[model samples]
Target: MMKALLATVLAVTPVATVTRLSLPPPTGPAKVGVVTAHLVDRSRPDPWVATERFRELMVSVWYPARSVRGHQRADWVTPGVAARINTPDSGFTLPVTHGHLNAPAAAGKHPVILWSPGFGMERTSGTALAEDLASHGYVVVTVDHTHDAQFVEFPDGRIATNAIPPVATPAEEEQLIGKALDVRVTDTRFVLDRLRTMPLARHMDLSRVGMFGHSMGGAAAAGTMLADRRIRAGLNLDGSFAGPVLEAGLDRPFLLLGSESHDGEQDETWTRMWDNLRGKRYRMELDGSAHLSFSDFQVLLPQLGLPPDQVEPAVGTIDGPRSVAIQRAYVRAFFDRHLRHRDGRLLDRPSPRYPEIRFP
Candidate 1:
């Protein structure tokens, strides 16, 4: 929902003078390696457009690499996705990722985690978190829901842009978002199915699978977990809930993370979601964060050097590096506790190490 909403809004803002942007380094010991695959779901026809007969998706699979000494650094995003994210005229270059391209996977099978980005945002939106997790020995897969994302680039050099249109009313918007969740849920399931049999299947322990997402993608995480038992855990970052998950809460582990302004008090959806949880559930908030702080946008937008007033509307007042650090730490901790059976004690309460994280 944001490429048109935020990207269009961003177009009107004063362009930044900053020429280049770089992501922060990964915090774990293992080297990160990533591979992108173009997937075609012939069983399902394109829902947003009538001309297309099947659904096509672009997916990035990140893993713990044994060695990246000779492999090349991966682009944070494909050139096409980069253009749709930042207007070409802005003259700001996108960041490069720590992921090495097609590097060899580490020896032991690792826990698998799937990532879904915010509405209208590409999979690259969660690059910082994915890389950090992979560096910690998790198999992190990021999915870009075709036609729903701002742009998706495939291996054949073809690009697919968003096909969904704006809605005119709140009722219509709600229905459209539900439909996006429908697509996202199905996309996630299909990706999980493919991953179980892919070449990297040897590197993944499918039984230890988890999912997380930001914004609409966050809702999809809950939605997908509800629809599939294969996913052992789920997390939602500052996203509201809609559809069946609201009524049929999950029995598995789940965590709801929110920014300062997004809470059960403000969003009734969060309250309903909290009430229906039947299993282990935890909720937390980031004190100085905003909706976008849960994403890579937290790291990139600040470099724009927008007026202080303008900053709050986008990524919030929190410093860029601090936001990334908090997210990488907490998100990693949740998965480590639930998926790896490694409780790092960071999630038990607010840690002095990350003062911005609150148990609200």
Candidate 2:
């Protein structure tokens, strides 16, 4: 779920002075371009906010750019989303990103990777990973599940927020999460269908599509793969299986990348899901990382001057840059081997470069 406000407060021991925050530059050779589209799913009603007539979504597409020389950089979070996430008294300013906004897509049909952020989190929470993949010649599509996300700003200036209320019991929590997962799965499939007919379709190799998500988003990735045959591979970052995939099993390539606190051994859900995998599968854990380390929060939270203790429980004990580097490397490797038909030796064994990572 979007970083829990209560959890953030409980995790942080001492709040530090606010300072300038910035995301690291994309590590690939090519420049990145981003474009946002506002879509409405007429077939479905708003799942969380029942008052809405239809399900509206905001999706950001990041891709390799023809040139970044004259393009404008995008904001890490749009003004509307930032407003909803930050209080008037909060001293934090959202970071500026490195993506060239609305720049022309680079020539070539590149493989696609669809990304979904955690529950209540903005789509931009996955921007770092998306931009990295885009820079490496992948067309990355990140979706903001309207009414499920903390805030989704549409082109017409409407802002949608998570309307699902807090749950009081475990059963209630599970029911809410299950409903959210169903909506996420549908949102993903709808986005893919729309992408296939958009102008960007010319530059996307849809047949080679893959998906990865953080926290609840990761769980949605698994469910999406089960529901949509278009997704050839799926990766879950610190998310547990909460859907039918746990019993039905998956027949395509799947990877489980988790933090020290939860892996195949530590979490029964992971073990159960791992056992159900019927196709090519791999599981690995980052020794010092936490649930949010696989997300942009690994860097963003630290830059916001949140004390290490406050961030560590959620993002883990790993240094922000190191965590991001390991994620970028491994995620790229997984997709490369599965989608691009490349040999990603890094996934085959333990590597000296990231000794903190362990295979199970």
Candidate 3:
């Protein structure tokens, strides 16, 4: 009867082509611990109004917990932010997720995964990746770099919108990337410190931790790993290269997953990082995926009924399900190999199951 029931569940759910790691239909019964922190940096200069304070950021931490019997799930994003992301007829709006809301006392000692989202996107925008990692037994902390992101929503309903940065030109994209990376690295390091001192998180395995992100977040993860040795491993989910990450040489285990447009085992930026990596390194390219494919936008796009051509494809992207699955497998495998010391064949070679991915 148990086997039959499991089979039925699998048959009804949408199975990812990669790894055959089928996920049950998305639901909200699990409770994820969440906390919002305000971080102020003195080194960053406010380009918008010429403020001395470098930057301020709002960060949210999501982790698996033992109980959620009465906890209210957190909103995917604030209503106002959702409206903007899901503009009328834009087909980017996601279904309301009652994810774990503000619950301070419900903390756990799970390993951590620091997430950074794409350019001009909110921290919560990577809900798909965040929630997935949390479900698989990692505490995921995401930060919204005040001016870089659209808006950051905290548990108290305090919303921080993008403060006008002094510089907002395309030429300064790299500058914004650096500023955002600065905020992310600080936020992550602070959180790590806070966790070490937290009496509630005594059970968390501080020694085992990783970082992963899409787009700019991906770049930040690389940069952070180089700066902080606390990070055991890192994964870049289709983010473009940036800053010293390319030049600094990564000595830790890292994985770079790219979309068709950016996938290159020998690209200049990646090649340099590859050459610098003194530890384990792996690279995989998803032919059909695009920049937006790294986030929840992949799953949300189809739900909104937007044709593939309308959304991220103007820049060359893949469909949502495939993109999400590819990410799900590579990330899980990477973490498993490094954090758990598990031998997952998925990381060793390309699988016939997901032919869309190529590893050189």
Candidate 1 positional error at 128, Å: 0.4
Candidates ranked, most accurate by lDDT first: 1, 2, 3
- State the lDDT of candidate 3 residue by residue for 1-360, as single tens digits: 212221221223232321211222222334555655665556555543465455556667776656656667766766766665444444232354434565443344567777877666778767766766666667777877665565666456666655535556877866765766776666667656666554446646788989888777788888889889999999987776777777777888999888776744435677677777788989888886666667665665444333445555522456566666667777877897899888867887889988888886
Residue range 84-167, candidate 2, lDDT tens digits: 555544556567887999888889899999999887777888888899999999999999988777667888778876687888
lDDT of 2 at 69: 80
Which residue segments of model 2 deviate by more than 4 Å?
Answer: 1-18, 86-89
**Candidate 1 per-residue C-alpha lDDT over 81-125 given as tens digits, one digit per residue, 9 for 90 to 100:** 666656757757778999999999999999999999998888988
lDDT of 1: 0.88
Model 1: what TM-score? 0.96
| Model 3 stretches with alpha carbons more than 4 Å out | 1-31, 39-55, 83-93, 102-108, 154-158, 163-176, 197-200, 265-267, 312-319
Whose lDDT is greatest here?
1
Query: Best candidate per TM-score, number?
Result: 1
Candidate 2's displacement at residue 329, Å, is 0.4
Task: Please provide TM-scores, in order, for all candidate models, with all chains considered together.
Answer: 0.96, 0.94, 0.79
Query: Between prediction 2 and prediction 3, which has the larger TM-score?
Result: 2
The TM-score-based order of candidates, best leading, equals 1, 2, 3
